[model samples]
Target: MSDAILTLDNVTKVFGRADKPVYAARAVSFALHPGRTLALVGESGSGKTTAARLIMREYTPDEGQLLFRGVPLGKGDARALRNYRSSVQMVFQDPFASLNPTHTIRYHLERPLKLHQKGLTSAQRQAAIVELLERVKLDPKLIMPKFPHELSGGQRQRISIARALAVNPQVIVADEPTSMLDVSVRQGILNLLNDMKAELKLALLYITHDIATARYVADDIMVMYAGQIVEWGAVNKVLDDPQHPYTRLLLSAVPDPDRRFDDVRFADELGRVEEIRTLSARPQPETAQAGENHFYRPFPAV
Candidate 1:
């Protein structure tokens, strides 16, 4: 995207010895644009969290770089780093663990305003907190004074979203924001994200293993496997007619109410799971386009 607020340019993060390297992220590249969401979909060990950590600056890239608004990160001075921190906010996976049990929702939202949004008077900060709470669909009057422990899973997650918004961040990296909540409330959170993206024009990086939710909330999608982005494009194009074998493998696993146990396509993909994993792990720099917007790495030779 030409107007991407944040871009990962050929970023790589590795662990273990140089001779026997473990690739957590290998040449991963994508962009997050304002008012749109880029979903990173993968299995648990497929380097999804590693990518989030890279953006959060909890772990530095072993190769390549992160570009925030066209400027390379880590090279800038402390003030630039602080600006990056406030601009890129993270909503973690677990709402229960992300917030303090003792802290009221008001406190959680107030702290960020005090830090990043300095110069707000006490009354102004309180108003800002109320606005944030309302933005996330929480009733400020009822929610502000309640401790994290008093809220339901979904409400606490809403508070998490409110807290992230407190900094007036341009980008939000939500790592499985709805996974812990009941399936009934998941859509509410997703709707809130979509509303925030449209109304506030915030760029969103939604990281999840759930294909159904990805299809619902994302504008674009990247299918990651074995530390590499094997396929990516407009969400409907990529998910409707997946090109990569690994991408097909993931779609095969999603429970289909209409698909029978003896469905041939399901059996075929599931049968090659091991083979697909083995081949997908090998580095494939070559790319192939399936459609105008859909693209994938060509499957390696067996």
Candidate 2:
């Protein structure tokens, strides 16, 4: 009953046929409050993207419903869905792939304004585009005329962000926005995102495998393993005092170092992480709150 902008109530996503199906997301539940960020952290194939997809309305959940400001979204109304799309935007993982190579950056930003802000004239649309570019700290005159490939990776990412903001979105789902950029430029992008969130008060869903980056922007963190959220709470509390085995296994992997991305070092702990993942994925039998904010889904037999 919180004043959350977006909430997923026991969301689940299954793939393949009934006989042999994979539950990409299992009863995943979380809320994105206005002016705050939620960091969905896990290794690859841990259902981080699946959660993002569910929020973005790209994939419908088979079990639960998605609520926007406490009202469930239905397919019957075009106007509501259109408004939802305009308010909810996304910045993809690969900036280059997200943009069109043939089109200039200005074209990309202007199209959204034309579609969403019909009240604005051509002159006003152009001005808005320039302002959007400047908001991401990109020089409008120089960067707007250039194509996607002409700019650097970081610049392309800035353009991607600029486009997402063109329609004046209230929520942004950035799926690993910095994972593709060079290490040197990653900090700049992270800072830019932090600034935008503060200025616009947008609810952001930052999906990534890098826990260190998540610590920088997220107010809350949800640790996912084997397509389920095993631990979730305030960012520092859960990350600093992680109780679940899979959460600890994810933290032990040196995120900034040259360590293997998938190499959960605790892999040798008598299958502790995987065993916990399978056990945790099942529905929690009852509520067991650890503290004011900390919560963990207990294993079936543990």
Candidate 3:
């Protein structure tokens, strides 16, 4: 994590009341390194989107700090804030909603370039836009004139990716980039994201509930529950031999052709779902190293 582009250090975001607080994110810490993807995985209401929002500056942290390139991101400095905004970009979950319905694909991609790269002339901006379209593997001539509605779900998602890349971002926070796409096209999008990370040397935070896709694209993985990262480590280490109960619970839920339907081990894990969740949600400040690259926050003693 020495070369982290973005770091969330014990960051917490709370909502509701002081008397009965709701922790959207509680002392959550993770780092995004250049040329690597760190996946944040959990079910809905598990603070996955909240963490993304914190990085995007949509929700300022109630506690801890967000660091950009080893410097604490402070709100007081206007120039620094502008630089942070330009450096970090996001690809939303719903591709259709992220793009403006009235604007052509060209307009959508061109607007970011016009705003961020103001020195570029109109002709130069057009060329840059075409380059971006090609980077996302789209035919610029055929897709540029079409509106969001005119493209398929997969194409629109590609446009979203193109727009995020338009700003020449150092960090790309993609929230469930493949969840909304057709199964047939999901792999293509995942492949494109992996390619972008390697080619652009971008630090990526890929958020999703799908462990399968996370394993496919991510270098490291974080398992979150009740707003806390209960377990995290190298993708294969965490997935192959999950250390935390919640991580095991999640992996068990994924379909396995080799495992019998009446397998007793999985059934036992499923039966204790509520019990495990309850224990895992409690504040556990203690972390134990499970392997050379694997670690988990131990569940608090009852």
Candidate 4:
């Protein structure tokens, strides 16, 4: 997208020995545009978290560059770095762990304001905190004084969201935001994220292994395997017609109401599909367009 707030241009990060390096992220590329959510879906150890880390600046790319508002991120000065930090925030997978048990919810929210929004008076900061809680659909009066231990998983996650918003960030990297919550409250968190993306025009990167939830929350979808984005495009087009074997394997794992538990065909298909998994560990740079907005790297002939 031309107006993307953040862009990962052919980014790559590796670890292990030079003779046998592990490509955590191999020539990975994607952009986060405002008012949109790009869901990064994959199994554990699939480099989804690696991509998030790259964006968070927790791990700098061994190759390629990250551009924030069209300027190279690594080349930024101290003030620019501070602006980048405030502009891109993260809502982590574990809400309780991301928060401090000793601190009140108010403390969690107030620190960001005190740091990034330095001009705000005590009263204004309090008002901003209240507004943030309300934005995440929490009751500021009730939640402000509670510690992290007192709140449920869902509530803590909301507080996390509120904290990210405190800095007025443009990009939000939500790594498995709802995975730890109960199934009943999972939809509520997804809904809140959707609402926030629309209302605040935030660019959101939602990382998860749940294909079903990705379909629910993302405008665009990218399927990662051994660090490669095998397929990506508009959520509906890619999910409905998954062109890559890895992408199809992911969608196949989601619960299917029409398929019977004892069906021999279903089991056989899964076994056959799994063969593609090992092949994906190698780099596949070739690509083919499946639809106007859909694309995938072709699997080597089985």
RMSD of every candidate to native, in Å, equals 1.0, 2.9, 1.1, 1.4
lDDT of 3 by residue, 1-302 (tens): 55888999999999999999989999999999999999999999999999999999989999999998898987756666666878999999999799999999999999889888889999999999899999999999999999999999899999999999999999999999989988999999999999999999999999999889999999999999999999999999999988889999999988778898799999989999999989988887899999988999987888
- Candidate 3 accuracy as TM-score: 0.98
lDDT of each: 0.92, 0.85, 0.93, 0.91
Report how far residue 271 has shifted in candidate 2, in Å.
6.9
User: Residue-wise lDDT of candidate 4 within 158-226, one digit each (tens)?
Assistant: 999999999999999999999999999999999999999999899999999988899999999999999
lDDT of 1 by residue, 50-74 (tens): 9999998888999999998898887
Q: Which stretches in model 2 have alpha-carbon errors above 4 Å?
A: 256-287
TM-score of each: 0.98, 0.92, 0.98, 0.96
Q: Quote the lDDT for 204 in model 1.
A: 95
Candidate 4, position 291, lDDT: 88
Lowest lDDT block of 10, candidate 1: 73-82
Worst 10 residues of 3 by lDDT: 74-83
